[model samples]
Target: MQGPHPVAPPLVALTKRAMGGMRSVGGRLACLFGIVAALGACAVGPDFTRPEAPVPGSWQNAGDPRVSTQAAADSRWWKAFEDTSLDRLVELAYHQNLPLQVAGLRIVEARAQLGIASGMQYPQMQVAFGNANAVGLSENIAKIGGLPRNYFGYQVGLDAAWELDFWGKYKRGVQAEAAEMLATIADYYSAIVSLSAEIARTYVMIRTFEVLIDQANENVALQEKALEIAESRFRNGATSELDPTQAATLLESTRATIPRRQTALQQARNALSTLLGQSPDTIEPLLVGPKAIPKAPVTVAIDVPAAILRRRPDIRSAELYAAAQCARIGVAKADLYPSFSLAGTIGLDASTRGTASANLFSSGSMFYLAGPRINWAFLNYGRITNAVRVQDARFQQLLVGYRNTVLKAAQEVDDALVGFLNAQAAAAFEQNAVTSAQRSVELAISGYREGAVDYQRVLDAQRSLLQQQNDLTESSSSIATSLIALYKALGGGWELRQNDPVVPERTQNEMKERTDWDDMLGPSRPQEPKKNAAPAKH
Candidate 1:
């Protein structure tokens, strides 16, 4: 869009610049016509083909035999937790995380770099120049030759040149840059996947801390009541002084745990706030009271391990880097061959005597020239050959790196699967333990009140109950966090970025104020944004 108030250049200068510009442009067009007639050569390089995703037909730990191959991956896996707060938190992180935004900006940078490389495929030079001259006559020379010794001269013409792509050197450069751009896009998705997992993990930790804190407070209350009973009995001369001391000791021990739990809770909250791109107070309102930790869905689905090779962003990025390196190999190899190009000039020049004006557009003033050029690096053959070898070596390294990334992605998913499955089992056992301990605490306390058990027995039971409850909370949180890691390894969540602007509105606005992006920051059009699938129900 044009600025609200536009400024116009002076008409005379505008006309002059336009006229001068066309002189070179017209020459370039004529040269391009001849080049186009001969430009039917193939791009010299190995075309890119995506490597097969080396993955197992089925996950070793898929757990269920009934899982259908047709099951769709969860695009919104966190929503399976059925926790509205977590849903909101993930969405907020997507919008606000600065590091993820920086990743998006890297895509923009790569895109501009690609444009620079692509432009090299076109003519490299075109210029128009004008010159004027005057000379004073020597009367002695004029008398001898009967020639005018005073004269005025003027010249104006185009200069143009284009390096032909017969060996596809420039084409290979464009290919390399295009692949690099894809790699950056993949990295952007990888960043979002990592950010989402971090946010969920931190939030779960906060909730876990909250649960532990509540458990400690409850135990402290129980111990305090026990101490009261012991004090009442001692005052009535019915119990020993040692009994109240033991009760007081138990109460203080439980109370001491509160401060540590509170500290962890605050720190976890702070971490979560940072992930949300906000101040520490940002989560305070959402956590006004204790809330249960998010629970994993009952049924988990996983794609065959091979599916992850296509789904994971890190793997995709590694593969694209390899492709880019492969293209560079061709670009380097092309340096060994002689280069071809075309050069030309066309426009007007005129001379006038006395005070008469020159007619620059007259047929007598017109002139033209055009030709082909070649360059060889025959003396630098060793350098060019070694450069080709270097590119090939780099391409091999990236290819290996891509394979390693695939292996690592599968390993991560396998590890997460084991961790999540075990966490669920452990949480189940802890739930049972909590239940039994709760009953034991009640029985021990009742027995003591009726003088059937000692205060020591009541203390043991209460302590065990508190420990069991805390363990259960940790197990539950683990299940949730492990699920998040699994999804991350599976490369979910980034698909949401499709149809969304790569640059945030605020950042785009700031860029516009500081510099002209010149269509770089415009809406991503032409290319269909990439979408990734999610892991199946567990």
Candidate 2:
């Protein structure tokens, strides 16, 4: 559907540009033809072939008990967390992130390149009309030379040039360009997935650090109280100075961690800001602490390994890159043979001359012409051979890249499962330790004040208790962070986005003018817009 506006800028510019281009050839119709000489009109080079996907039916040694997965890999797993803040953050990133924005621009670039490549298959024609003055030069020049030049000559004609795709070289180029466009699209998907993961991870870490800092502050207060009690007992000769001094040192240690934790929090936020394509300052307010963790959902499907390809954007990007390389190789191979092409031009021109050297166009001249042409490169066969080799090497390199992407995807899922599981167990253990230590601290301080126990015991109990409190908080953060990693490793979000990036209304209208030259001799007709399939991402 078109937007509710008249003559958007994109359309206006495209219209002007197309008109300029069409007018350049005296607005003539040029006959376009090709020889495709390779007896088969087939490209002399190897045809593009997709490399086999390394599809593993199942993950190796897979037995991480599936936690409650609320959504499948190809679903928006973040929604499972039930964090409205997280959902908002991801949506914002998709719309405004700079890297994502750049990826969109790349799509435009790829389209322009495709257009250029497609042009190679067509013949080029041009026309010109001008009037030139003639000097006094004719068969009777001596008699006429004595008489000054009298008139001007006018001339007009058509010029045409075309190269055939006999070897299919140009066709291969178009194929490669088309493949490249697909690769760029995959790249856009990959960027979106990566940004979502970074944002989620950073957000989790921010909350975790907040919890850690809060616990540290609380522990320091408890330690201060313990130190004061120990000092009192030492003055009364009920405890040694060693006990009071140790308690003070312990308190200082906990206090020292504060600045470092603060710095780390800032850094994670800064990193996240850049990923969102903003300055750190821009993100500070947008991503403050205390973001609610999504409700843990109980049963997301843990898919088979083969499904990962369909779920992960990086994997798809890699595969498409490989395909692009394969197509380019076909383009290179097609260079080894000859090509045939045809072209024609029809236009009118009239000119006038002042001097009479010999005028031809003065009476109104115009012409029509058409023909076929051939381009053969047998002597440069070695060069073509080298080009084919180079493309082969590139194809091999991209193939390896694809395999590595798959391997890494598998490894990440495994790693996330392990970390998440361990974090759960560790959190449980730390919770127990905190309860026991807190109880022990209370008893030890009471005993020291009553002169029933040395202050040393009080100091020891205070230290252990504070450590436990800090550890417990850290454990919570760990579990949450691990969960974030697992969700990302499995590829989160994007799949849930129901629409493609909205193109500027003007640009959509503009694209129409570029697609045709009004089909003048045969009235212009508009074709239905194509439907694009957003690639699947788990």
- The per-model lDDT (C-alpha) reads 0.77, 0.65
Q: Candidate 2 regions off by >4 Å? A: 1-41, 60-71, 125-153, 278-300, 343-370, 502-538
The positional error of residue 457 in candidate 1, measured at the CA in angstroms, is: 2.5
In Å, residue 128's CA in model 2 sits off its true spot by: 4.8
TM-scores for all candidates: the values are: 0.82, 0.78
Of candidate 1, the 10-residue stretch with the lowest lDDT total is 528-537
lDDT of 1: 0.77
Listed per model in order, the count of residue pairs whose N, CA or C atoms clash below 3 Å is 6, 22
lDDT of 1 by residue, 1-538 (tens): 5755332233234345555656776686667656743662545656656655466666667755433345656878888787778788899999998888888898889888887887888888988778988867676553534445677788877788988887777877877887787778889889988998898888788888887888888888878888888888789887789889988988898899999989988999888888888999768876653467877875676667777777888887887787788778888887787788778776677777635666766655666676667788889949988998898898888877777788788888878878888888898899999999999988987887777888788888988988898889888988888888888888888888866778888999999898868767644445622211111112
Worst 10-residue lDDT window, candidate 2: 523-532
